[model samples]
Target chain A: MTDITIDHVTKNFAIDGRSVTAIDDISLKFPSGSFSALIGPSGCGKSTLLRLVADILAPSAGKITIGGTPPDEARRRHEIGFVFQDASLLPWRSVMDNIALPLEIAGGPIGDGPRPETLIRLVGLSGFENAKPAQLSGGMQQRVSIARALVLRPKILLLDEPFGALDEITRQRMNMELLRIWQETGTTAILVTHTIGEAVFMADQVHVLAAHPGRLVTTIDVDLPRPRALAMLQTPAFNHLENAVRAALFGDELKAEPEPAHG
Target chain B: MVGPVVFVVVLLALWKLAVTAFAVPPYIMPPPEAAWTAFLKEADKIGYALFFTLRNAAAGLLVAFVLAIVLAAIFVSSRKVTHAVLPIVIGLRTAPVLAIAPILIMIFGRGIGTAIAVVVIVSFFPIMVNAMKGFSSTRKNALELMHVLGAGWFKTFIKVRLPFALPFIFAGLRSAATSAILSAMLAEWLSGAPGLGTLILDASSYRKTGLLWAAVIVSMIMAYTIYWLTTAVEKRLTAWRN
Candidate 1:
C-alpha cells in the first residue's frame, strides 16, 4: 500500500522580498490505489501541492509522506511519477526513447517494470514508436508523456492539468483513457485540475480548494460505480455529485452575494 | 543560386568597367584579366600559402570549440563559479586580438604556435557565449522531469542539456568559422608565417597588385566555404527542428 499523506503542509514563495503564502496549512490523505482530484480556480496552489507531493518542490512547513516514507525518499526510490501541463518530451527523441528515459536514468529497468515497447502499445501508440514529438499532434504527445510517466510503474502518479491544453472532445476521451489506465495500474493517483466535470468524472473523491491563501474548503465523495462509462455522465447521480462539488467550491461566494427577489 | 550567380557576374562586369573607365593604375586596381592571369601564373605558390593558412586556422578553431564547450559546461554547473569567472572571460574577450597578438608572438615566437594562438583568441568568444546561453535555455519542465526521475546532475547534463544546446552551439560555430581564416591570415602577417596573408604582403611590397588581389579573393573564398560547411553540419545535426 502506497498511500500519500500530507500533514499540515504549507508553501510560501518569496516574491520581491515579500513572503506570499501560496498554500495555507492543508492536510489530506490519499488512500492506497485510490484516485483523487484537487479542483480549484487559478492561484489555488493545486499544482504547487502536486509538486510538493512529487518532491519537485519542498514544503515551507509541515511534511508529505508516501506510504511510510518522506517524499524525497519515495522520489529517490523512483516511486513518484509526475506529468506536467505540457508534454515536455525531448524534441530530438523518438516516442520510444522518451518513454525509456526514466529507465535509463534509473541505470536500467527497475524490478521488471514495463518495457518502452509495452508502454507504447499500452498507450495506444504502437506503430509510432519511432515518430518524433514534432510529428505527433498535441494529444498524441501528451499520450507519449503519459506513457513516460508510467514507464517506471511508479507507486504514486501526480498529474498537474495534463490535459488542460486539449479540446473538449479530446479532453473527455483522454479523461476516459486516464481512468482506464489508473484502474489498471492501481497506483495512488492525484490530478490537479480547474474543470469541475473532469474532477467529478475521474476522481473517487473531489477535494475542493479556495484561492487567495489556497486552502482546502471541502472533500466531496463520489459514490460513482467502478468501471464508469460515458453514459454515466448524463445520469442524475453524476449531476448531483457535480452540483455538490460545485457548491463546496463556491459556497462562500454564493452566500456573500446579495439576494434577488423578483427573479 | 541563379540570382547569386547573376549578381556575381554583374559585380565582375562593374569592376572591369570601373578599371577601364577610370584608367585606374594596375598597382592600385588591377583589371579582372590581369588578376586571373596572375592567379594562373602563381597558382602553386598561392595554393601552398592557402593550404598553410587553412591548416593553422582549422587547428585553432578545433581547440577553441572544445575549450568553449568545456568552459560553458563548467560555468553552467555552478552559479558561484560562473559569477566568479564570467567577468574575467568577458574582460579577456574585450581585449583586442591585435593588441594581444604581439604579446602572443613574443611568447610563442614567429611560428605556427603564434598563428594558431591568434586564431583562437579572435574566434572563441561567440562560441562560448552562445554555448552558455544554450545550456541555460533548457525548459524548466524538462529539468523538473529529470529531477523527478532521480537523474543525477551528470546524467541530466548528458541526456538533456547537451542536446538542447546543439543549435545554439552551431550558431556560435557559424560565426566563429567566418573569422577563423581572417585571424589566421592576420597572425601570418605579424609572425612572417608562410600563409596567404604573408603572400599578399610580399606581392604588395613588390607592386604585384594582380597577385595581391588574387590572394585576397582566395582568402575570401576560403572564409565563405568554412561558413557554408558549418551551416551544413548544423542543419544535419539539428534536423529535428524541422
Candidate 2:
C-alpha cells in the first residue's frame, strides 16, 4: 500500500584500501502496488540496492523513503520484507514454525495476519507444514522462504535472486506463483535478478542496470496483459519486451569496450 | 549388533581356553568362568557402586551443561569477552585432570563432591568448544534476514541461532557423556570412595584378579550403555538432520 522513492542514492565500499563504487548515484520511484524488477549482470549491485532499500545496508549518499518513512522506520513498522537468494530456513524448525517466525518476532497474537496455514497453502506447501527445511527440495524450500517473508504482510517485498538456484522449469513456475501472490496480496515487489525474461514477464517496469559502477541504464515498462501465464512467454510482445531489456543491458557501449589484456 | 555380540562371546571363550591351556596362575590372570562367578557373587555390591557413580556423573554433566550454555551466550554476545576468556578455558582444558584430582580430593574430602568436580572438569571443555562453534555457525544472510524482519537479539536467538546449534551441541554432549563416567570413576578410585573404581582398586590390592576383571568388564558395559543412550536421544531430537 506504499510507494518507494530512491532519491539520488549511492553506495560505496572500502575494498583493499580503495574506495569502490558498488552503486552509483541513482534515482527512481516505484508507484504503490507496482511490481518492479531490477535486472543486471553480476557485480552490478542490484542486490546491494535492494539491501539498502531493506535497511540492511545504509546508502553512502542521498536517501530512500518507503511510503513516507525511511527504510529503517518502515522496517520497524513491519512494512518491509526481504527474501534472500538462499532459502535460509532454520533447519530444526518445521515449515509451519518457520513461517510463524516473523509474527513471533513482532510479539503479537499467533497467526493473526494471513495465518501460517493460509500462507502455506498459498505457497502450495499445505501438506508440508510439519516438514523440515532439509527435507524439502530447493524449489519447495524457496516456497517456504516466500511464505515466511509474506507472513508479516509487509507493504513492500524485496527479493534478491530468490529463485536463482532453481532449474529453469522450477524458476518459471515460481515466477508464476510469485505473480499470483503479488496480485493477491497487492504488495509492491522489487525483485533483483539476472534473467531478462523473468524481469519482462513479472515486472510492470524493469530497471536495467549497468555493471562495474552499478547504475541505472534504463527503465523498460512491460505492456503485457494482466494475469500473465506461461503461454505468454511465446507471444511476440513478450519476446519484444525481453529483447528490449536485453538491448538495454548489453547493447551500444558494450560493443565499443575493448577486451581486457591477458595475464 | 548380533554379530558383535557373537564376536564378544567367541573372544571370551577363547580367553577361557587360553588360560586353561597355559595353566596360568590366578594371580596373573583369572579364567572367564572364575570372572563370571566373581561377577555374580559381588553383583549386589558392584550394582550399588555403579549406581552411585552414575548419579555423581549425571550431576556433574548437568553442571557442565549449564556452564557451557552460559559461557557460549557470553562468547556470542561479545568478541572482547570471548577473546579474553577462550584462551584461558582452552588452557585449563589442557591441564591434566589427574594432577588436579588430588587437590580436589583434599578439599572435598573423599566424597561424591570430589568425584563430581572431576567429572565436571573433564567434560566441560568439549561442550564449551562445540557450543561456541555452533552459535557462531549462523549464516550471514540469515542474520540479515533477521535485521529486515526487525527481530531483536532474543527473538533471533530463539527463532534462529539456538536451533541451528542443536546438532553441534549434541555432538559435544556425546563426547562429554563418556568422559563424565570416566572422570567420575577416576576420582572415585583416587579418593577411595564407594564406586566401581573403588571396587577395582580394592580387588587389585587384595590380589583378587577375578573380581578386578569383573569390575573392569562392568565399567565397559556401563560406558557402552551411556554411549547408546546418548545416540538414541540424539537421533530422536534431531531426526530432521537425517
Winner by TM-score: 1
What TM-score, over all chains together, does every model reach? 0.95, 0.90
Model 2: CA > 4 A from native: A14-19, A109-112, A229-236, A253-263, B106-109
B43-108 per-residue lDDT for model 1 (tens digits): 999999999999999999998899899899999888999999989988878888777778998898
Residue A185 shift from truth in candidate 1, angstroms = 1.8
What's the true lDDT of residue A200 in model 2? 94
Please provide, for model 2 over B1-242, each residue's C-alpha lDDT reduced to its tens digit, 9 standing for 90 to 100.
Answer: 99979988998989989899999999989999888999999999889888888888898888998889779978998999999998988887788877877788888888878887888788987887788888899888888989898988887787777777878888998899887888888888778789888888899999999899998888888887888898998898778777
RMSD vs true structure, all candidates: 2.1, 3.2
What CAPRI grade goes to candidate 1?
high
lDDT, candidate 1, A1-263, per-residue tens: 99999999999999999999999999999999999999998998999999999888999999899998999899999988999999999999999999999999988877878888988888889899999999999999999999999989999999999999999999999889998888988899999999999998999999999998999999999999988899999999999999898888888776686877885
Clashing pairs in 1: none
Best by DockQ: 1
> What iRMS does model 1 reach?
0.7
Supply fnat for every model shown: 0.93, 0.84
The clash count for each model shown is: 0, 0
